[model samples]
Target: MSESAPTRPLLNLDALFDNPVFAGGFGLASLGAVLAFARRGAISTVGLIRRRMLVNVEISRQDPSYPWILAWLSQPREQTSFLARRLTRINKLSVTTTTSVTANGPTRASFFLQPGYGRHVIKYKHAYIVVSREKQATAKTNTGEPHETVELTTLYAHRHIFEDVFTEARALALQAHEGKTVVYSVRNFDWVPLGEPRRKRPLGSVILDEGVKERIVDDAKDFLARRQWYVDRGIPYRRGYLLYGPPGSGKSSFIQALAGELDFSVAMVNLSEIGVTDDKLAFLLTKLPERTILLLEDADSAFINRRKREADGYSGGTVTFSGLLNALDGLSAGEERIAFLTTNHIELLDPALIRPGRVDLMVHIGGATRYQAAQMWDRFYGDVDVDGAYRERFLKRLDELELFGEAKEGQPVTRTSTAAIQGLFLFNKNDMDGAISMAEGLIPPKLEAEQ
Candidate 1:
C-alpha cells in the first residue's frame, strides 16, 4: 500500500482552519497569550491597575450609577471613542421624542440611549471608560424555569479614576434633570423608583407663607449640611417632616418643588399597599437612594386607628404601626434619607408614630392664601403677549372673584386649593376669563340638602 502513503497524521490542519468556530476560538486564545506576554512588564508596573464597577438594574431597583455612566458616555463632544460612532447613529435615528415639562416649558425632550458596549474617554480625568452589558442567569422560578437579566458593567483605568468618573457622571444626571420634577410612588412594595415627571410648580411658583417655605427649605439644607454633625453626635443622619393638610393644598406640590430644588430624587411609599410587610418595608427604606426624599402619602389611611388596633387586640394590617415607627426611626433606613409623612387627618394617627424623634418637623399645609392666588395667576398668564384689553378683562374678573381676599395675615382664612385653581386653569387653557369664572364657581354651597 505504498507504506500507507507515509501515514500522514489523521488530523488535517487545513480542515481545522476551515471550521470557523474552532479557528476563531484558537485565534482568540493565541492573541490573548501574545497580549499577555507583551504586556507582562506593563502589568508589573505599579499604579496602573484596571478597575471595574458593576451597576445593576434590579439590585436595589436599578443602580443610579448605570444611568450616570450612560450619560457620561453619551457626551456629544467625545470624538475619540467607539461611543462617538454609535452616538452619531443614535442622533440620526428617527426615534420617538419624549417631551417633559420644565420651568421653561414642555419644549424640552429626552432621548434614552440604546444599551450596548461602548468605549469612551474621559479627557480631563485622563481615563478610559468602557461600558458593557452582562447577562446573568437568575434563580429558577416556581415552574422550574430559568431567567436571564442584563446589568451594566463599567470598567475604568484605575480605582481613583472611577471616583472622578462617578462624580462627573452624577453631576451630568442632575443637570439632565434640572428644572424638571419627578414623582415616585411605591410599586411591588419593594420598588420606589421614579415615575414620569410632570410640569410642576417650581419652588418659587408654589405659594406657601414666606416663613413656611424658608423654614422647610432652610431646615432641609441645614440637615444635609449637618451629616458630620450627626455622625459626631452618634445620631442617625435622618430627619422627618410631617405635612398635614386637606386634600389639594400645596403639600405634595411643595414636596415636589423641594425635590427639584435640592437635586434630590423622590421615592414615595404607600404603606397600605399589598405585600408591604415589616421586613419588606425595612428593606425598602434601607435601600432608598442616599439623597432621596421619601414620601409616605396618606399616612392616616395606612395606619388607621393604630390605638384602636392595640386596644382591640388586633394584630392585622399590611404593615403594623410598630413596623412603620421602626422604619421611620431609621432603624434600617438609609444614612442620608429625609422622609415626609402626609395626612389629611393628623388626629387619626397614633401619637407614638409621630413623636418627637420620628417627626422632627410638623408643617400644616392649609388652603392657598392671597399671595398664592396672585402668584398662580401671574405665573399662568403674565407671560402671555395677549391683547392688553383681554388681559385687563381677565384681571378685572379675577379681582371680582376676590379669591385673593379670602385670606389675611393673622386671621382665619377660608380659601380654595392650588390644585382646584390649577384644574380650572387647565380646563380653560388660554382663556383667562373662563378660568377665573370657573375657579369662582368651584366653591361649594355652604348648606347642602340631605341626600
Candidate 2:
C-alpha cells in the first residue's frame, strides 16, 4: 500500500486543463452553447419587432368578407402568380366546381383553382401584405365542411389599406353574383351558399292565377318600402307569406322569381332537416342576411301530426309547433326578415302557425287555371300567336280533355297543374298542334291522384 501511494502522486487539475485533447473538447462545447444562445436571442428579438411594427386583420369563415377576400386572392393575375412563387414552392390549390357530379365522377365545367390553407405573400401598391390561412379550432362544422380563416398582416398599420382591400374584394364578389340568384342554406349556425349562383329566372315566365303574382309582388314591395312605418308603430319590421296549394302549383318557382324581381338572395330553410332544432331555426331567422328572402318548403310536413308521422314510420325533426310559432314572432323573432312558407296541404297546418302576424298573407296558388294556361301559351309563342289560331285550338283541347275540372260538381278535381302543362309543352316544344294532340292521350296527374 505504501509503494502504490508513492507511485500515484496527486491528479493535477491544472495539468488536465493544459492537456490538448481535453482543452480542445471543452472549447468546442463552450463555443457551441454561446452560438446557440445568440441565435435564439436574435430570433426572439425579430419576433418582438414584428409584433410591435406589423398589423394584422383576421377574417373569419363566418364573415361574408372571407369569401370576398378569397375571391380576390384567387384571381389569376400577375400579383397572385408572383406571390404564389415567393411564398412557397408548394402549390396547394382547391378546386371549386360548378360542374355536376355523376356516378362516373365529376363532369367537366368551369372551375376556379384557389390557394388552399397556406401562407401567401402579395405586394400591394405600396405595402407587402402577408396572408396566412389556417384550419384551426374553427374548422369543425355541423355539416362537416371545413371552416377556415385568413390573417392578413402588413407592415403598414393604416386602416385605409385594409378598407381598400375589402372594398375591392366586395366589388369582385358582387360581380360574380351579378345577374344571378345565390341560394343559401344553414350549416354550423351560419348561412352558406348551397351551390353555384343560378341565372335569374324571369318573373314573366312564372304563370299564376289572375293578379296573384302582382298582389304578392306589390305587398313585398310595400313591406320593403315601409320599414319606417313599422319602426314608428313599434312593430317588428318583418313580413310573412304562405303559399298553399297542390304540388307543382308554382309555389317554389314563384318564390325564386320573386327573389329575382326583388334583387334579393334566397335563403332556403328546411324545417325538417335532420339536425335543425327549434333553437337553430330561431337563430337562423334572427341572423338572416340583409335583403334576403327566407323560404320554407313543405311547411306542413313539420306542422302535421307527430304521432301520425311516427305511425307512418317517418321520424320527422326536432322543430316543434310551439317552437316554430315562437320563432315566427317571439321576443327574438327578429325584424327585417321576409319569410315565405309553402305547403301542399294547408289543412294539415295548425291554425296558430298562420295567424294574422305569422302569415300576414295566405295566397292560394291553385292548379292551372284558364287565365294561367293562356298566359303560359302566349309566353311560349310570344307575338307569333297574334292571330290566336293556335291559342284557340289549345283552349278547345283543354276543355275536351276536361283538364280544367270546373265542370259538373261530382267530377274529380282534374285541374292540371302549371308544372304538368309546362311538361307537356316542353315535350312538344313550339308545336301547338303537337301539344294539343298529346294532351288528349295521357290522363292528367291531378285527375289520377284524386281518382
Measured by TM-score, the strongest candidate is: 2
Each candidate: RMSD to true structure? 11.2, 6.3
Q: TM-score of each candidate? A: 0.64, 0.80
**Candidate 1 least-lDDT 10 residues:** 52-61
Per-residue lDDT, model 2, residue 114, is: 75
- In model 2, which range of ten residues has the least summed lDDT? 305-314
Residues 120-195 of candidate 2: C-alpha lDDT, one tens digit per residue = 7776566777788888764554567676889999875654588889999999988998999989988768887887
- Candidate 2: where is the Cα deviation over 4 Å? 1-48, 79-92, 101-106, 137-147, 157-159, 186-190, 273-275, 305-318, 405-414, 441-451
Candidate 2: residue 82 Cα off by (Å):
10
lDDT: which candidate is best? 2
